[model samples]
Target: MPPVLVKGALHFMLVYARDGHVEILKYDLRCSCLSLVDVPLVGPGIHGAAILMAMEDRSLGFAHVDGLTLHIWSREMDFNRVASWSHRTIIDLRNLLPIQNTDERLRLIGSVEGSDTVFVTTDLGIYEINVKSQRWKEIWKSEKFRALIPYMSFYNPQ
Candidate 1:
């Protein structure tokens, strides 16, 4: 629901149709310029199933979950400054999580700053997953569905 900041710009996903076709827009902080970024066509019609994140190298990254599969993409730029998304990683949620029902929905709540960990919410509980290691553990459980937002800030208790 919130834009990710990378390379001095804020990148956000925009759904311009009923079927959930997404477009990424980059807003430059220095020049205040807004431009469209070219990303590969992800699965359509799965509303609220995608999230934009800042990669370790400070580039734009995207994650989308379809059924039991999770897709991750990273943005790349050519010599001429042309931008595109490169499909990077795919993880099977069934093997990663302790899932009982195949029909239970999985939503990517958010990602931890400065790490590859992502928070996923399901009927069972909320789990933190390390995308690189494929390791996960349940962090919280709730009777009703809950959404999580990752936030980071410096504390100065002076």
Candidate 2:
């Protein structure tokens, strides 16, 4: 179970499982815990809290909601939230692979090893997002990548 500590007093916990299982379990947070008007929610992930989207000045902040889109706070103090609002860009969440590449996506993960970026994989290829620019680009595009170097360690035989 992962938890998000908000405003100090409130605790938001996210529970997850496979598609068939209920993710949230006995959470300290309930729909009533909020201010009624959806302020901004920062979701919890496997290890830490993840913003379906986030904005930062120097430190990191996260916000995310399942079923709804991910919202990030942006740096432009005038922009207000962690994610930008003036631009209002909507990213299609469908067809995106999970953030966890520890499983079969290990090979896909290796490509972005050195850089401080996040990769979103699809049948199309691997797209790396620049943390600063929030821009996404394709770094690799073959199924063959799934068979390369780190992807081929015989010890962890798939």
Candidate 3:
């Protein structure tokens, strides 16, 4: 189960089987309610996925990065009501990332708070990808590094 927090709620990605349909469960902590968010058919090559929120507009973002390409989907979400989100493909990272074949390993780590950028780690380095701008920047690189594990947090100054 892959989980992400969007608009102060928990969204979980539940995959029933390999190469099967995917469903999202939205859990509201305030009311302790869980609702299923229907999703369209997902491709079979999806290996890495992440949920993101655009900081400027607070729109929801979903990314599924396969071995040779990155597929991004986004939609507007209303937290106050039980609304069904409709997503559309926004960008493809094949032009940006150096992917030669389907053997390359890629993983969508997570998104940065207060920004529309999400982090993806490969064998080469860690990259920051902006969903709205369709841009990417390499933040870290190491020849000996085989994988990257990321940690995220929100800081509140009240």
The global Cα lDDT (0 to 1) of model 2 is 0.34
Candidate 1 lowest-lDDT run of ten: 142-151
Error of 1 at 66 (Å): 1.3
lDDT of 3 by residue, 1-158 (tens): 24566677777776667565677778988888998876544564442454444344555556666554556565564677655445544555667765444465677776764466767776677788776677888887842433333556769999
Model 1 per-residue lDDT tens digits across residues 133-152:
98998888862434467668
Error (Å) of candidate 1 at residue 148 is 2.3
Count clashes in each candidate, considering only residues at least 3 apart in sequence or on different chains.
0, 17, 0
lDDT of candidate 2 over 3-77, digit per residue (tens): 323322232233344432122222225453442112233223322223222223331233322332233332233
Residue 117 of candidate 3: its Cα lDDT? 72
* Stretches of candidate 2 exceeding 4 Å from the true structure: 1-56, 63-70, 74-116, 142-158
Comparing candidate 1 with candidate 3, which one achieves the higher TM-score? Answer: 1
Highest TM-score model number: 1
Candidate 1 TM-score to native:
0.87
**lDDT against the true structure, each candidate:** 0.79, 0.34, 0.61
Candidate 1 residue pairs that clash: none
Better of 2 and 3 by TM-score: 3
Q: After superposing candidate 3, which stretches have Cα over 4 Å from the reference? A: 17-20, 47-56, 66-68, 77-89, 98-105, 142-158
| Cα error of candidate 1 at position 4, Å | 0.4
lDDT of 1 at 49: 73
Q: What lDDT is reached at residue 30 by model 3? A: 84
